[model samples]
Structure formats: structure tokens, C-alpha cells
Target: MGCCVSTSSRSTCSTRSHGGAVSPSCFEVGFCGQKRTKRTFSDHVIALQHLPSVPNRIFTNGKSRTSCIFTQQGRKGINQDAMIVWEDFMSEDVTFCGVFDGHGPHGHLVARKVRDALPLKLLSSMHSYQSRQNGSGRTCFRGNSKKSDGGDSEKDGSAEDRLNSIWKEAFMKSYKAMDKELRSHPNLDCFCSGSTAVTIVKQGSNLFMGYIGDSRAIMGSKDSNDSMVAIQLTVDLKPDLPREAERIKRCKGRVFALQDEPEVPRVWLPFDDAPGLAMARAFGDFCLKEYGVISIPEFSHRILTERDQFIVLASDGVWDVLSNEEVVEIVSSAPTRSSAAGILVDSAAREWKLKYPTSKMDDCAVVCLFLDGKMDSESDYEEQGFSSATLQSNHSGNAVESDDGQKSEPSLQRNFTVRSSEESDSYGRLPPEFEGNADTVAAEDQNWLGLEGVTRVNSLVQLPRFSEERPNP
Candidate 1:
């Protein structure tokens, strides 16, 4: 009465041993010793005699498969990061999710780099410098705890200072590595490649966040009706600010380098005036390395007590389509992280569908991390399929009233979950030495930013004429 689901013990692997376990498909297998039956779900299940302990493809719902490739070779003609990984053993608390939407060809590489290294960088930097005795040549965080005026030091420290120590070191190291990789192996797809980083670190009940570039981190929960508290952390590192514009005029607007284009994301006029950023600030664009691409990340701490709502981390794609508060309401209403991720991606895609109308599809990737929740049953993913994305014509998106005639807009439409795709198990297609490392890792020599940064594809995408070929904002 059980199908033997082979377990490779890898996060992406989904084998089936029918001991009250379920696969999306069903198949029958027969053996020589005794008549045996194995139920397969989707295309993942197969029946044969003397089968090896491992199967190339594991059981998957078949809605979608994890390509893990950021190159055009892996792009599935749509912009969606809809992954249903770790079918059963996903961690209930402290879920880490991120979205890397690249403005140019290098987007894919940027996305993969952050997913693999960003967290490790943050935690590692925090502990490394804080350690009193470390042989690594990095600076020890020994700032004066003295008071400004000869008075007794009342302020031992602010949370920002402690957090900034880590933020500064981690960002410095990560950006330097990212920039080095980008410069060495330039992705022709985008002459200027940069991405927004939004990280959600929920340690215990304490919620901490840090971001660079315009990728936003918005908060959502039911404390204040359907509205979400959009506390923006990172500022656009663009040189086009009014103050920057004025500074440029004063300096007679000195000659700009290939990287000094103020039109870049975080690049300000008069070059060294403000935090030097071409596309403002980012994790991996090495072109702006000379300008100290190291971005001072906005840091904050919030105890995720009863009043907090679901958290969202998305690329500029979602933000470009929806407002910050609008996103909060949408995800807050979402029952699960998977659905929330799906809804964000799909909704963004729909918006592109309307704007481009006649053009081909655009890429959109979204990931929503539901804070501290439990998924005890399958219905958690909705009964039939899942939540979906649709065209929203009438969006008075600017902070409206709720149906009780209350002024808050309910972010999610009730009873909405569109079932899209599921990951396909690798039972046969994998090489003998096949490990799931490549999906989440790059080759040792490929570490463009200390992790084998891959400048795989560099196709010049089409855009409106007279506009910047590579879109950074």
C-alpha cells in the first residue's frame, strides 16, 4: 500500500516510498522476488525490475521544474521564481527568501550570487570582526564609546551601530567580491549589470533587515487593517538627485568616466560628492568599484511580536508594478509563503502583459517569506491548485478605503490561489556524479564575487529607442 520513494536526502530531491506518502502521480512497479507495486506521481514515477536505489527524476507535481539556470538556456520565457522545493521537510520557522531582478544580462548571475553568498557574508562578517582574536587582516570594530561633550556616556550604543558594524563589513566584502567578478568577466547582455538586494533575517522573534539599491523591504500584518507599513530601508544611489545635480553645476560638472555616468543608479554628480554609486549602490557591479561601490545598507530591528504581519522580499519588477503598501496588503492576505510568492510574481507579470500588450513576455521573479508559521496539512496550499495572477484594470492603488467603508484597502482578493507549476524530480537525467550543487552554486573558478560568479549569457535585450540599452532603475 506504499510506493517506495527513493530519498537522495537533497533539498531538491523528491523520491517516493509509499508508506502513507504521496506523489503527484501514480504508477505500478513489479519485482521478481514478490509482486510489488509503487505508485508514481506525475512523470517522476517509473516501474522496472532491479531498479537502482536512485532515480533520475523524482516525483513532481509537474507544474514547473527547477532549471536553476540564469542564462537564456534556463529562462522559461517567463519571469517567475515559482519553486516548490523540499516537498515535506521545509523549515517551519526562520524561512530565508530573496529576489534578484537584474536590469541587464547580468541579472541572473546577480540573483544566484546573492541567494548563495549574501547571508553567509552577513553572518560571517558579524562574527569575524567581532571576534577579538582573528588572524584575518580585516579591521576590528573598535569605535570610541565616549560621549560627545565630556558628560557621562549615557548611550552605550544604538542598535544601528552594532548592526552597522556587520552591515558595513559584510557589504564591503560582498560588494568588493561582486565588483571584482563583474569587471573580470563582463556580461555582454548588460554592459552595466546591477541588482537590488532585500534580505529578511528573522532570528527567533526578532526581525532584522538590510538592503542596498531600490529593491524594497515592506512589512505586512493585520495590526492596522489591510494597510502594510512600508518602512523603506535603502535609498536610490542615483547621481541624479537635486542636491547632486546642484553639486555637479558647482564643480562645472567634471568629465565622467564610462562608469561615472550620473544616469547610473546610485551615481551622483560631482562624482565623489555622495556615496559613490553609478547605479547608486549594489552587491556585485564591479564597474563602479573605483567609486567605492560599497553601499551603506539601511539597517533596523523589529521584534516580530503579535502585531507583525507576513513579510515580502521582491525585485524592482514587483515594486515597478505595485505600490509598497499595495504589496503589503496582498501578501498579508495570502495564507502561505508559496502562494504569496506566486501571487507577487503573477501579479507583476499581468501588469507587464497590459503595458506591453503586443510585445513578447517579460521576466519576473518573486519570493515571499511567511514569518514564523506552521503548515500542518496539504490544504495549506489551497484545495484544488493555487493562487493566480490576473489583470487588475481598476487599481486606485493609492491608499484607499476598505469595504466596511473603512479607509483601508484589503490587499488580497478572497479565495485566490492559482496552481502554476511543480518541480520535477531528478530520477534519471542526472549524471552519476550528479549533486544538486550546481543549482545553488557556481564552479570554484566561476566565483565572480568569491563564489565563482558566472557571466554566462550577454544578449542585448530590446527596449524603446533612444533609451538606455541596459535598464538599471
Candidate 2:
């Protein structure tokens, strides 16, 4: 017998799954009157599979308040962006947030798939790191420990090295697993579809960011003179960059800008230009996988201080119309925490109408995380003339100190390429022969960011198989 569950006070009911989960398509009439289409519901289910089981705590945290707003591109069939904002993501003190921008036919599905699964996979990798270290009692990183002139090698090197090594391994493996999961999903079609991801996991004051493609993470802070400033956190992985174009060309892919949009360089097939991808790295786009597009993410860290006010994560829609400084201004001047994202989206939508009257507006989604509970007005930020010396001094160098007083470099800016089959597992682990050589690692060689193995792709050129639960989110 099937069970019926009540979602709220309204007279609506949804079927409960006994073992297998119920399809997300079945929505009660009046309760969910504004019903989502079949495709959209499917995408939501795919995303919900990996969401943390914690109760809804949206707009609840006093110190670290969070809010989100997603608006469809004017008259576009559906919004292709997906976002996740978890206040107590893994633990009470940890908060997790992500923004995904999808493109191509099945881009929405691809974005939802990553939104639901990436975080869970990352947590599993974290567990694996702990397990490996517990069994071995040694660090996994390779390279000569770069020492500071007056710093103690013993105290500074031991703990920070172990943690950094653990995080690097976890990030690489989790991302690899996410891509593998997408490629293996039977119902979903990803041959020409892909998504860009920008995620942040904040524990205490430490911020760990994992980013791919062009969606961005930026911080709004008070400078030395107490003037609000915008600090870009992730590099925009657009095909226009020299390094990105070079890599794409090396892999036999073509990079060029369309006549109308000369500023936006895109990656295309050497022989065909049907699917010109605008980003250099992404989770799917299997058609271009062999042609230079990859799933590896750039990693960075930041130690938040009193001057840091808030952080913003948004899709290109917001970035396209609003400057980083403008976004900071809008968010800072908002009346309350719950309304900041909506205000930003509304502002962008207006700009889209005014600037590109003939073009379809891109979907806009924004996530604002307020570090300090106070919401200051624009005038308050622009009092100006205050010396930004202290704020500048704090971030002058990329190095950040953890709560425990150990200093670690916040940005790990390395180029990630597709791996070969002999390289690593789906979790990006090195094939047994490459383990246990921390002393021999060469700092100059940027290729070995994860475990010892290389990247690989399946050669079967066909539609993906369909299963109710194969990819396992």
C-alpha cells in the first residue's frame, strides 16, 4: 500500500515512497497551484537527492544570514540556474552555498544534478581523507615546505600541511565523481549540455571556495578607511583568457568570438561550431570533453575578519548587468537580510530591459551571506576618506591564517586538465603506484594537484542509458 503525506495546512497531498522515492512530478492541485513542468520537476528531484537532510533554516542565522532570488530570463522557456543555501550545511558552525548556471538543451538538468550531488560527494571525500590519515598517521602532500624567514618549520608545517593535503584531495575527487555521475545518468542527456559552479563552504571564519566556469563569488568589505569595497574571490574561467584559449587550441578545439558578441570568446569543435561553449571548464558538455573542456575546479581560501561585511554568489546574469561594486552597493543598502537577493535580481531585470531591449534577458540568481548582522546603507559605506591601510594590509598577500594561528596560502591557482584512464579513480585518487612520496613532489610542476592518477573518459558515443537510481546523485 502507498502512503500519502501532508506537506502543510493546505489541503494537498503527496505520495510517500516505501523504498524507492516517489517521482517529483506528482504535485497536489491547490497546494502547489503554480505547478512546475514535468521536466522542471524531474530536475528538482534530481537535485533534492543530494540536499542535506537538515530542516529549513533559511533566513534564520543571526550572524550569517542568507537569502536567494532566481528569476527567469524574460520569456525564456525556463530558468536554467540552480542554487543551494544551507545555513548549517554539515554541522552547526558550517554553512554551505552554491550557484550553478546551465546552458545548452539539457543544461538545467545538468545544473540540478551537480547542485544535489557535489556537496555530498565532497563530504564523503572528506571522510575518506580522515580515514586514510587515521590509518597511515602521515601527511599526503608532496613538495618542499616553503619556509618563512623567522617561522618554525616543525610547528607551522605539520598541521597545515595535513589539512591542505586533505582538502585538495577531497575537492579533486568529489568534482571527478560529480562529472562521472552526470555522464553515467541514464535519463539525463548531457552530450551538449553543461553547467558552471561556484561554491563556498564556510567553517568558523575560514572560507574554502571551489569554482568552475564563469559564475563568481565576491566579498563586500570595508577598506582601511571604512569605505566599502568589492574583492573578487574566484577567477572567471572564460574561454577568452589567454591560458584558456591556449589549452583549448592544444586539445584541438577552436576558440573564437561570434561577430555580434566579439568580447565573449567561445570554445568550439575543430570541425563544427554548433555548440560553442563560452566557458573553459565545466561539469558536462561531453561532446567537448575530448576537446579541452574539463571538470576540475580552482580552489581558494580566505580568513574573514571584522572588516569583511558580506559575501555574494551570483550567476552571470547579475554579473553581466551589474558591476561588482554595484552589487556590493545594492546588497549593503537593502532594508533587511531577507530582501537583499530579491532587490539585486529586480535591479538586474530592470537593467536588462533598458540595455538589451531586443535580446532575451539571461536568468538571474543571487545568494547573499551577511557576515556581520548589521545592514549599513550606501551612504554609510561611502563616508570615504578613511585610510584603507589595515584592510589592504590584511589581504595584500594571498596567505591567510587559520583560527589555530597556522598560516596557509588562500589561493591554489593551478591549471587542471582532463585525466587519462590510467591516472586516477572516479574520486581522483592516484593509482596505487603514485602514493607515499611527499618528499619527492616538485613545486614547479603544476600538473599533480590531486592524487597520483590521470583523468579518463568513456569512448562510447551514444545516448545515456536510463535507470531510476544509477547515478546515485
Candidate 1 TM-score over all chains jointly: 0.49
User: Once model 2 is optimally superposed onto the true structure by TM-score, how far is the C-alpha of residue 296 displaced, in angstroms?
Assistant: 0.8
lDDT of 1 at 66: 15
lDDT of 1 by residue, 1-473 (tens): 11222222222212322122222210111111223344212223212221211222111111111101111111223222211121111111222334444443345445544443443344344334434333443332212222234433334345325543554455466544444544454332223445556655443343545555555555555435744454333333333434333344454432232342211323322323322233344555433433444444545445454555455555544554465566666666655443565566666667545643443333444545444353313344444253221111111111111123323221100000011112112101111121343431122211011001211111112221333343342
Best by lDDT: 2
**Candidate 2: tens digits of C-alpha lDDT, residues 116-224:** 6776677666545544554676432211123334556675467445545556667788889889888988887788777889988765455678888878788888879
Determine which window of 10 residues in candidate 2 has minimal summed lDDT: 1-10
Model 1: residue 390 alpha-carbon error in angstroms: 24
* Best of the candidates, TM-score: 2
**Model 2: residues with Cα > 4 Å off, grouped in runs:** 1-53, 56-73, 136-158, 373-473
CA RMSD of all predictions: 19.7, 18.4
lDDT, candidate 1, equals: 0.36
TM-scores of all predicted structures: 0.49, 0.65
